[model samples]
Target: MKRNALYAGFFAILSLPVFSADRKPNVLLIVADDLGYGELGIQGYNKDIPTPNIDSIASNGTRFTSGYVSGPYCSPTRAALLTGKYQQRFGHEFNPGPPVAGNEPIGLSLAETTIGDRFRKAGYATGWFGKSHLGNTPEYHPLSRGFDEFYGFLGGAHSYVNAGAESNNPVLRGREIVKDPGYLTEAFAREASAFIERKKDEPWFVYLPFNAVHAPLEVTEKYEKRFSSITDTKRRHFAGLLSSLDDAVGSVLGKIRELKLEEDTLVIFIADNGGPTAQTTSSNGPLRGFKSQTYEGGVRVPFAIQWKGKLPAAKVDDRPVIQIDLLPTALAAAGVEAEADWKLDGVNLLPYIRGEKTEAPHDALYWRFGQQLAIRKGDWKLVKGPEANAARGGTAGKASTAGAQLYNLADDIGEVNDLASKNPEKFKELAAQWDAWNAQLVDPKWLPNRRAGARNRNSAENSAAPASKWKSGDSFEDDQAPQIASRAFTISARVDAAAPSGVILSQGGPQQGYSLHVKDGKLALSVRVAKQLSTVVSTEVLPAGSHQVEAGIAPDGGVTLKVDGKTTGEGKLASLIQKQPGEGLHVGNDGDAAVGEYTAPANFSGSVAEASVTLQ
Candidate 1:
């Protein structure tokens, strides 16, 4: 009788509803890509367009003036945010390329545990909506990395209005590709609101990362009309895109307030990095440079967080904080203990933010983008971009590397004044720190085209720096080496039905015994037939001593192969690969592509990128 009574009492205690005070708050991490700080009304933007939605976040919560991302670029900052560590420490310091033949793998190594992964372990529902450029491969996918649900495009950027422009790569719901008819940004907001509503009962962590304001500017008439008075075409288009994004931000906030989950949720709003002033009419204001540099303009962005009644109301923190800090802070707020073995690089910022701790949260923040490097200690910064076009003559067409530049951010936010001469000792010290940190990184498997410099919304003609002005090293760098060195390669091309479609080999050594191949059309019907040949992509293997291999496209369907500049072999064109009817195919690694595609083939060998076409 006594034992039974005790057991009943314990059960009763466990069943009792834990008050809001006892439960962890839901977390909504809203991130914008390439958003400028001054663009928000609260951030001192004088533009007619109102960002009430984005501003409301700061109005209701704490706004951070010195908020910084681990890196100036997208992928590195994302990696740091997810892992709560300097991405350079893990060799994820640059953007991974497109899905077909990406320069690097999809995501952080399995060794790194993401915030979503941590939240899931803490009995919280984890959801990721919007941009997921972390990684495209199965292993690096959000579903595999602690996120219970994912809805977004896997690639870095996508067209907003160009429906079906990218085949089969439509907006995704979980692992399945779902066609989304609404504008992409608006649709993401809808999905995000729906997610919050659906998971209201449980503790949830929702990551809403918008791809708006990044590139390939797409805007709706509703948004466009708001910016009609603006004369500059690109700026007008950019404003329209941002307007849609602002509304999307508004929608999620409205949903939160409507659900009356304000106090129970922790909402954070930030940009992936600083705005591309040249690309978007959006101004970085007083800040200098744009995305892809380590200056304040690139890594420092608008950051605000709100926890309603729990956190102090309407305060500003001048202290610096990086994206990585959110992880441990979220975990701490949830009353979960970070396993000692987990070894997170970020500290719990709540104590410091709440005035409980007086010390600075971090001693330094580091970044590594290929050979480019930066280290921020206090207000001093050491920045460097590798030598410009070392190999090629300093011709206009050759790839040029921008040499090192150092600045005292405290004095020069524009980076206009290079203080390397004035502060040689400080520069040397920071440079040493950067080099030591960079030396630990794994050499790149493949060099990818720099995302910022490539043809995007921010053309040099329109930008603060002209496209022609950017040197080779400043824009392009060798891609990190791949883990699967011997197994991977890529091909890409801007297809024009009227022009001669040729095979272009982008990576790997030679196609001697191993063949670089592609097929057009779906594999629903025929198997052995030639189906449709795509400028028969082939190349001969280079001799072991040869450092480079060459591939040629003949007027005929077959491709001419060469190893070490010598012609190897010619093979008849055939559709060896097959694709399903709806599936599309791509090959090669990262941009600078050369693969061909035919929408309708008798039998489709769905697109095969980095396919293992072994001779056997």
Candidate 2:
């Protein structure tokens, strides 16, 4: 009888909600898109971009110095955060490419249970607002994936100001399109505050994944005016975006306080991934590498959690924690015990936050992004990725380099010192642990154009960089390329040819596509639609020192070719290709299935560049 009483009492204590005795607490999870490690005022380095509302989460509760996301990108981190497991466990390793008609594999696997699903099952009203990159297909929509209320773009990104009909990814309100969504961040704030206000009597979960601070940076004058002092154009723009995000956060926070739900709401804030410093001027201060790489700057991000009157305020926890923990922790706070069969990779952090547990929330955190892989155990990390891209010798950009380097992050936060040769034992141990984790994960549901693991909104442009920037023998997946149908576009190139007889640029295949090449010692343009071919060769022939080639496609099905500012050839087709070219864009060679009347690997012999011409 004594033993039975003790067991029952322990279970009761563990299962009790961590809020007032009336009802379960509401959960407000705010995720920022492509934010950097050192971009916030609270992060100590960035004084320019003040984020008081975001910083308040830390001032009110706890701040994690070594906070991280599971993957270095958007969708993969989101997958892990929602499922409470490593995204790779179920093969959600990369961002699913642009939504195509029959491409059904491009989404989060239906097998995995989501946090929204769990909350709904537990009788909580659940809502998701902002970017849903999981998949854009009907079956993969948030409504189908357990979210009761979804008001965001299905693709990785959407224009913040343009809620127009022509966009590839449109703003959605439930199943209907939102044609007139005023400024996205503020719109999200209003919707979220309204949801919380109406659902005050019931348990609720609100996911506000703001797509700010990414690319195509644009904001209203109200936010931009606040940063008029900063002069650098890009930096000034970035400041405005950051300010806008902070204000949006403040609006939501204010609502909770106004409703007297401060103590009964669990507020968590984290960035989807680190900054893409090259694309946007976002900084990952005191950290090396950018968004696409496996360095600290790519994976580490600002993280804070607050539940007033529950977790201690004004605390800083240096122990490493990850986005995956949010799911299990939220579940725990709701007084729901995680099932044994869930196989969750995240730990319930309530105990640790309350000082009931002293150790780290995670003994080890692992990541596998395509060719890149990392495992951080304690202060030591074993990583193999493109950190070599930072000008180190023999250390190539390939992650599967037979062996990964070791680093004690306690001393070398920048990862400059490769201690693998010195501490062979530690390196081997971590390598082995990463291998074990890798073996458990399945193959990805879908693959990107390249294994670059791009996490941005303009991945086709960003991931295709360095490889397709006027380089020979490089191909790029050009999704919804502007050349198709009635959409008019121009393809221009500058080349220095050794011998003027090769393919310059080509996309698609024999069935439907376009190509520009030097044919019969003269510039030629070809357009193939439904196997009906239209080839036009230049009237003038012969040599070249430096030449400019341009191919223009008119919406009225007129094609024109120009060489060195001279009209070479002109042709009228029945119609241009209607849909997206199935094949990818080839820089200097026709990859495999050629669109032109040339053999395979019609490689350009000379250099193609924006500026390779020199006048002696």
Candidate 3:
């Protein structure tokens, strides 16, 4: 905790006998998915969750107190992180939900060059492991984006335990669907460590983005037992998931230390976006809003940079720095200068951090998420749209301020008081500045499939309806679905199998939902809450004729799949699908979004004689 002394010691350690390296330093970028600012023990937000390995990055390096991502969601931040430019500039906005038939080029535009491309061009070995939510197509694959080696899924999220053929998003090894390799976070770490060991003698750039602590809240007993004291089941499981991610970070860092690559490597740890606190019980501390909104909790994330003997250690930098800065910072560390034609939005931080430059790295930071937009100049911030009232837990559709809401972030990190009315000039200046920046960006290449129907004003009031019925191809709006306080529910369907595989009934989108479907002749029931999925597959395939298939969820989160009154499969879910699906229920198809990994609208080919959804 002795700040100056620790920093001096770190510099002193650089002069050791192992410090002979005329070669460019290797770059290691680690990104956690939906990680909250309050999760880290070092952050003093959550004392129960221990993240020693992650905290080590802060202890041995400089932690940015006000670090942020360009976007409030997954894909957009990734696009910006890789391109070093605002993703809105290239129309790479919104999560490209399960592939649509004609939306072939729905990913990071090829016109933009990635940081991996720059490192590879400099003759460095580049590998990308874990989530690549940018695009699912071959052209948008990591290999096409400058990474020489790729191992992970192309979509947004995947199952941590079972990432095989049955999974909606299968784990891939350089484009080939491979068998599930134990837990996903561990597998990513193993692959990253192997890459480091193999390329120890060469300069390498490894991008390890672990989709941990996201959703579906699935954790093995190995991790689950660690948080037994946490009585809240949802938060307990989240802690376990976070612990596993921490271990994975330790694994990679262990390899670096074991191989003596720490001094010659620049390791950066950050999250793609803020945690979705409502669904997964992810605590963002006092920050406002969750993912998808332009609030501090949605865009602000834990960020740290470490270069063993190079950068000052155990220091906390409060200056505002964005994830886009990583690209130029890494390039600068790797002895590569980006060309002016690239038009990078990030600035290199080496000079500024080293005391060679005194001015702040960036004069202002900006954000744009759909109708929401915000801009920060020094300590003053101006936010428009729903973000202004998001911290108060208000719905996005609530009355807007018309022009903008202003706040002094330095004085009010929680974004409580709005100073717009009191200081009209500052608010107007920032709002106009945001407008000018917005004018330069292109329209979104594709928009997300927003939830239809009016918001249910009385979601708390349960209707007296006992059951709802549906037939083949019949769909219901989100409001039409039975609203229950508890997560317990039962769904039954009588179907005549006329095709090999298709969805019989489903609710929610890729982020969360549940579906009873047929895949390769087997009846499968998958309940998805966020990124975690609990699927129960029938032991026996359905007959060529009519059959009764039922899926039920108990209050305790136990799932059961029954075929003709006989239980065929069973599983458990740590958390319920609390996030309302954007698209509503579909009897014969999954609608615009998929409940699990299966493609959207995997419409049932046969007739659904009777489908009933009952709240337990």
State in Å the error of residue 288, model 3: 1.0
Segments in model 1 whose C-alpha atoms lie over 4 Å from true places: 1-21, 98-105, 385-403, 449-616
* lDDT (tens digit, per residue) of candidate 3 on 1-616: 6999999999988754343447889999999998987789888899998899999999999899899999988999999999999998987766763122344367888888888888999989999999998876789989999998998988676657766422335788997888857888999999999998888878899999998977757789988899999998778988999999999999999999988889889999999988877657777888887777677888889999999889989988888999999999999998887679889999998876666877778888998765677888889888764534333222223223356678899999988998989998887788777778878887666544322222333544323122445676455545445553346888899987544467888877666778889877888888777667777788878777788889888888888888899988787878667766554677777754567666445656567758977876
lDDT of 3 at 584: 60
Q: What order do you get sorting by TM-score, best first? A: 3, 2, 1
Pairs clashing within candidate 3: 168-597, 215-531, 215-532, 216-532
Model 2 has how many clashing residue pairs? 0
Model 3 ranges with Cα > 4 A deviation:
1-21, 98-104, 165-168, 385-401, 450-616
The residue pairs found clashing in candidate 2 are none
Task: Give me the displacement of residue 38 in model 1, in angstroms.
Answer: 3.1
RMSD of 3: 9.5
Q: Write down the TM-score of every candidate.
A: 0.69, 0.72, 0.75
Candidate with best TM-score? 3
Give a tens-digit lDDT track for model 2, residues 140-235: 888887788988888665556667522346788998989898999889888888888778778999999998876546678887788999887668
lDDT of each: 0.61, 0.77, 0.79
Q: Which ten residues in a row have the lowest lDDT in candidate 2?
A: 389-398
**What lDDT score is found at residue 158 in candidate 3?**
61
